[model samples]
Target: MTNVTPRSDIVLDVQDAVKHYALRRRGLRAPRRSVHAVDGVSIRLHSGQTLGIVGESGCGKSTFGRLITGLETPTSGTIRVGAHGVPIAAAHGTGTVQAVFQDPASALDPRMTVRESIAEALGKVAGRERERRVDEALAAVGLTPEFGVRYPHELSGGQQQRVCIARAIVDRPDLILLDEAVSSLDASLQAQILHLLERLQQDTGTAYVFISHDLRAVRQVSHSVAVMYLGQVVEQAPAEAFDRGLLHPYAVALRSTEPRILDEGTEHVERIVLTGEPPSAVSPPAGCRFAPRCPIAEDHCRSVAPDLVEATSGHLVRCHKPGELTLSGVARADAEV
Candidate 1:
């Protein structure tokens, strides 16, 4: 059986995080609208482990990443990292964590050479030591030292991403938030980056919060997986549980689109395709955000908001009928607690 033990050494804890953005008209009779970017999202990442977050575009994946890294503060709830056991609130001005954005080109300074870009992040270290750290970080991401002097424009998309990854690691942060870190890279390059990430985690033991829209990439790197819809976490479980069967409707639908991991001689399961656009986060539909699109959505889903309950060991989901929906040979492995 897969290791389902919740690692005792959790590096980051996000407890009921809620973030909302208020929209206001320019002047006069303007009513304010609040965009509910992250609504009651909770996650836990262990030291030296990768937690993959997956969702469609505008599903608050990026926003949740920002909240964890303290780039954007949560309107409610708290985020704590490595200090104690409690879920402490993440506040501004803390550099204990780092981030790598989606756009490799935009992330790097056009004028600064790769070495300089990485050095800037390690500015605290002076003289020859800082330069050596830059070299080490670049090498960690499989980039040659000679590539350091080149500007962002001179590097290929993959190379630029390597530089970005190097920049994030130069500081040797306890946690790194990678938002679509490898999405822009080619498939082969993406594999290289993913491999590098695994090695880096083993070497430095840094916790990772990896956010992506691709299930395949998430499956490759994550020890745990979280599925988001609208602004809430619909399903989260150990990677092994996801491999067995996803409990939430949204996760099952998303997984149906993922490439099958079977090596050979396995029956191919049909995909569970979902229809319709997600409801507005500002005024999300009653009950579940997925009800409007869920193939098995019922009256309970349309009327009452389902609480996030544990349906199995190391797995939590928000749905009225947690494991009632099945696909192919998949079955619910646990009951709601």
Candidate 2:
């Protein structure tokens, strides 16, 4: 299937997918509650595109990544990768799509050398060809061929993560899911890895679904961005839109709180910190999940859930009142002066 061509358009498509796990309280008579990890999310990744998913922890970002990459089966809904039409569940271990997991060190085999680890994905190729491919993959990620002989334990955290990346890209799969791939790296190293990934996509034409909590990183590397809140996607838009505006309150709050350098000087951003912890997944609030914390919430927002709708060109938002800006109240009052 390596030489087989894929359709030149959409590379990955996920329909309204839902994944829930049962959480039982320690009571003989108490009823079990379900934790809705990923609740009805739909997304599309076009050929050679990078779609970044950003959210607070427990917002189901990683779970959604796992679902799209076929690491776990969804409780309900479908994921289709490439033009092969393979069921996402059936695609795991077969390498139709691959994942570079969060914990880079843990994801690699401590006992196996990097060469062997990458080769494991190739079924059973000749030793020479396998070695060559391993070298090529390592080089593609800025690692030399000699590094392939070293075990995961011998490599630094960044090197180890590159090994994981090499393994994922070695087979030239149609798509890759990067789940917090650079979260553990230092700032400089993270930028290097992100640049390498961008180059890899350009060189190989591989589609990427980048899952990260770093809004700045998402802005730097992604073509499009999707914001998830409490197991649902509250907004999705082109990367540029993140700077202009975000319709969902959760997305707006996240963007406001993200850290950034002030015009490349030493001065760093002072963030707009959000109050309170995220609500429990077992029982997300009725109506808008963010209603409890939303500054502009009205009775209608508290009484009914909002569906994701197109708010602008290529921008999708889930909000009862899309044009109502919470801070605009202050801006309007100031404007009258």
Candidate 3:
């Protein structure tokens, strides 16, 4: 049985989470298969910290976000919220989970005013107090009360996202799933939203699962970063791992693409570039899912899978030859995390 013991500071705990969606049979005799959206993924997030999940499109990062938010149930494994490790039934509940999705235009209701939208998220608050809380949330997101009377169409893109943020925080949830929350906004607006998220975290101590394809944005907000590929984590480490060093080849290639990670006017000594897109999740190849695209792939990597092994303190990588590459990191491990 899973431990599920209570941990005071742990805000969210996930163990071997697997979410698969079965596909319809092509014919009566066709073998059944499922899309392996999120396979054997596990991570822990503490209060007031952000875990940034970065990966290319169709890599299942969004699906993982859905699992954490309870929007979709995992096909297997456990997701326990609140005081970490506490069994869901035997635990005290402070595990309010909320989500701020990518597009604010479609996310907000066309009919409801800003205050009304925020008040709805407050659930059962009285009229007067709901109004107060709504106003407060607006203020927290740097909006004025005058905007509250306006409809979704009346607000600009940035303002609409601010309303979305207000809705997520109006009830003061313990965990917020920010799934590409700022991706739709322009660079200036994205900076504003990112800063706003940080300020709100300081004020409310809300833990965040910030899922994005934008590695640059992820680095700005994450305490730790996890890179996913074809429904599995290729590497997990502290955000400093970007500069301090990354182990997995996939992670290295992803990092090299980010110009900001390199110093201004200085060429990176170990820039890795990989070709081709990720294979389909429905029928990913055997062994490491990243092996086909990995520049350092060997016969062993193609035929045999590698476990996510701990390399340094709190840094885990899934690769057959994690240490042999020019990626820049020492890799030695005896056990899995």
Candidate 4:
């Protein structure tokens, strides 16, 4: 779906967002430590688009999602929703921005029927209008009004997720944060849900922040992708980065893990095995966060930090050398690092 909205009409704008939670102390005079879940992350989303966030667990993609959806307030920075400057960190209600989490079973109340679950999200849309919207949303998610009478337990896994999607869209939100939305489902069901989301976006012009570990799903649904490392976004680029290869070492490492159905003349990229666990976010490395594990890292990489700069049109990468580091298509074992 092509969104021709004015350039000024940015649906979601997050600038230098940070979220840090203090660890519980064991002693009265113990050292104070905080986990930096999301650190200085900035992103802008347009209408009728999808920004897929991919990273390992605890990389702060979910925390970032919570910040934008207003589930949790930021420790610093601003998150604005809509061109009207309506702040999202504190004000995006269920109607303005919604979330479809991984576990559809836990998200829905077994006590409430499908209709009630969808209706609760309707907010102030009262009487006949409320009923109409619920039914319309059910239809949009490939569920009939008859299915609304059933409880969450009565429906299949895919059916329950469909109901959750219905609840999120019933209010017609400007943005939806789907945190591993379809990862819990079977592959076939995941494909169905992804297709449904795409259709819904096309029909309603709703923007989405799809967070998942599944690179295949992210690549399938995202107009653009942002790779988060530790607590910071290391690279951000258009969907073409998946095929054209990424600049940041961490981004390339993540991309290399996924198998590609190569076309004729396409090069086969070997999966780069990353050594060691990610450094603690409480005390991230002084220079590049990925330097300790970077196979191609040099002394300079370990000494200096790189700013997230525009490597090309709409592509931002945080790397001192950028493409100068022989990565992408080349193997680290053979490359002149």
Candidate 5:
């Protein structure tokens, strides 16, 4: 793993961000209820760093990504890019924040050639300058200028994704939200893309918000990791903390299930099989959204929501019992054999 030191300048800052969608009324008589897709989520990303968000489906990971990229406005809270605050009504695809979606096929317009797609992101730089910028963007992602004339259908999955990445960075945005950017590719291809992203960050000092359900991929790419449940962050820490040990019950349980950990034969770690589906976000549990599925829940945990407290240096967790529990982490080589 490469050593990454986050700079003092915060590239992205999100505070108490919330996004809700009201469901259609049944026959216009039933009381309308809303899906709390993203509820009071707060996170920060620094320049040349990656914050990986991991959770089950419908956990608001995607919604949070949308909020950062200005694809969807927050119902409440603030999103700031660098020193400037992002407006709720800001247009997507034109901000200092850009996004590379999961499906490259759908993300790229079928009618547009690779050159046109990348050039469009350059804003008003036209004529010879625009062509030069387009070529430069393509080269940044390891693609040749010849690929400019090819359409989305003509490229492989990996090449199409590279094009999407090029488009996102052509404008030299401060931050780029990658919503499951590598999940759709094969393992080998995923590694290649991950390496490419790391190189780009090193060269351009651009930050990334990497959202994915694949914990292994998250672990591989993120400088920090945030665990979300029921549209709220349950735990967050430096990636090293996850390999050492986690404080929250939800985070510990989720990490134990990763195949990499299991294959390594880590001691003292039991496979935790959580029961019951996550409760509806429309009306989540009164306290700790994870209390319903938590194995170590207590009476206090059931009735009161836990605030995010720093249990260790830079490790934040929302749990009634923060440091009282000792969980197993990935075993070191000496301990493994």
Candidate 6:
């Protein structure tokens, strides 16, 4: 793992951001309800750092990514790229942020060649300059200039993904939102992409917001990690702390379930198996959202929502019994890269 100093300059900052969607009414008399996709989430990222966000499907990971990339507006709160506040409905050409989606084919134009697709993202640069940048981008991702003439359909899955990455970085945006950028690829390809992303960040000093369900991949690429549940961040800490132990029960439960962690053994800390499905975001519980499924829930946890409190330096957890609980983590043996 790389050692990162917390910097004062923030490439991305999100404060109390919320994105809610109202469901269609079943009848005129029926009361309208809204799904709380992202509820009061706040995060910050420094230049050249990657913040990994991990959660189950429908937990609003994608929505948050869209919010940061300016694809979707927040219902409330603020999002900033560098020192400037990002306006709702802002287009992608602002040169502050870019996004790489899970599906490379969907992100690319079927009719456009790789060179054209990359040049389009360059946004107004044309002629020799555009061609130069396109070739440079392709080379940055380990692709030859010859591949630029090929269409998306002609390339393999990994090569197409490399093209998508080249398109994203060609703009040289300050921040990049990677929404499951490696989820579609095989294990070997995923490793290659992750390494490429890390190298790009080191070379360009660009920050990244990586959203994925793969915990191991998250650990490998991120400088810090945030665990979200029911549209809220439950725990956040430096990447090293994830293996040392996480304070939030939900975070601990997640780590305990990892096959690698269990195989290496967690005899010192208890394994908590949660029951029941997560409550709907449209009708989430009044208190801590994970309380219904938490193993250490108490009376207060059921009635009052817990604010994120720093249990230790730079480690935040939204749990009523923050430091009182000792949870299993990925054993040191399994944590070896």
lDDT of 5 by residue, 108-134 (tens): 999999999998888887799888889
lDDT of 1 by residue, 151-192 (tens): 999999988988988998888877899999999888998999
Q: Which ten residues in a row have the lowest lDDT in candidate 4?
A: 328-337
List per-prediction Cα lDDT, in the order shown. 0.85, 0.85, 0.85, 0.87, 0.86, 0.86
- Residue 17 shift from truth in candidate 5, angstroms: 0.5
- Score residue 44 of candidate 1 by CA lDDT: 75
Cα lDDT tens digits, model 4, 1-337, are 1234544657899999999988887799988889989999999999899999999998999999999889899999999875454787445563678899999999999999999999999888899998888889999999877898999999999999999999999888888999999999999999999999999999999999999988889989999999898888988999975557578878777776666788886665667778998889888888888899987888998889888999899999998877654454554333443
TM-score of each: 0.89, 0.91, 0.90, 0.91, 0.91, 0.91
Query: For model 2, how does the per-residue alpha-carbon lDDT over 1-337 read when each residue is reduced to its tens digit?
Result: 4456665578788999999998877698888889999999999888789999999899999999888877788999998887676678767777779889878889998999998888887766677888788889989999988887899989999999999999999988889999999999999999999999999999998999999999888889999999999999999999876666667777777876666556754354434467788899999989999888887889999889999999889999999987465345333434565
Candidate 6 lDDT by residue in tens digits, 134-161:
9999999999989999999999999999
Least lDDT summed over 10 consecutive residues: which range in candidate 1?
A: 85-94
| Global lDDT of model 2 | 0.85
Answer with 1 or 4, whichever has the higher TM-score: 4
The Cα RMSD of model 5 versus the native structure comes to: 4.7
Better of 1 and 2 by TM-score: 2
What TM value does model 4 have? 0.91
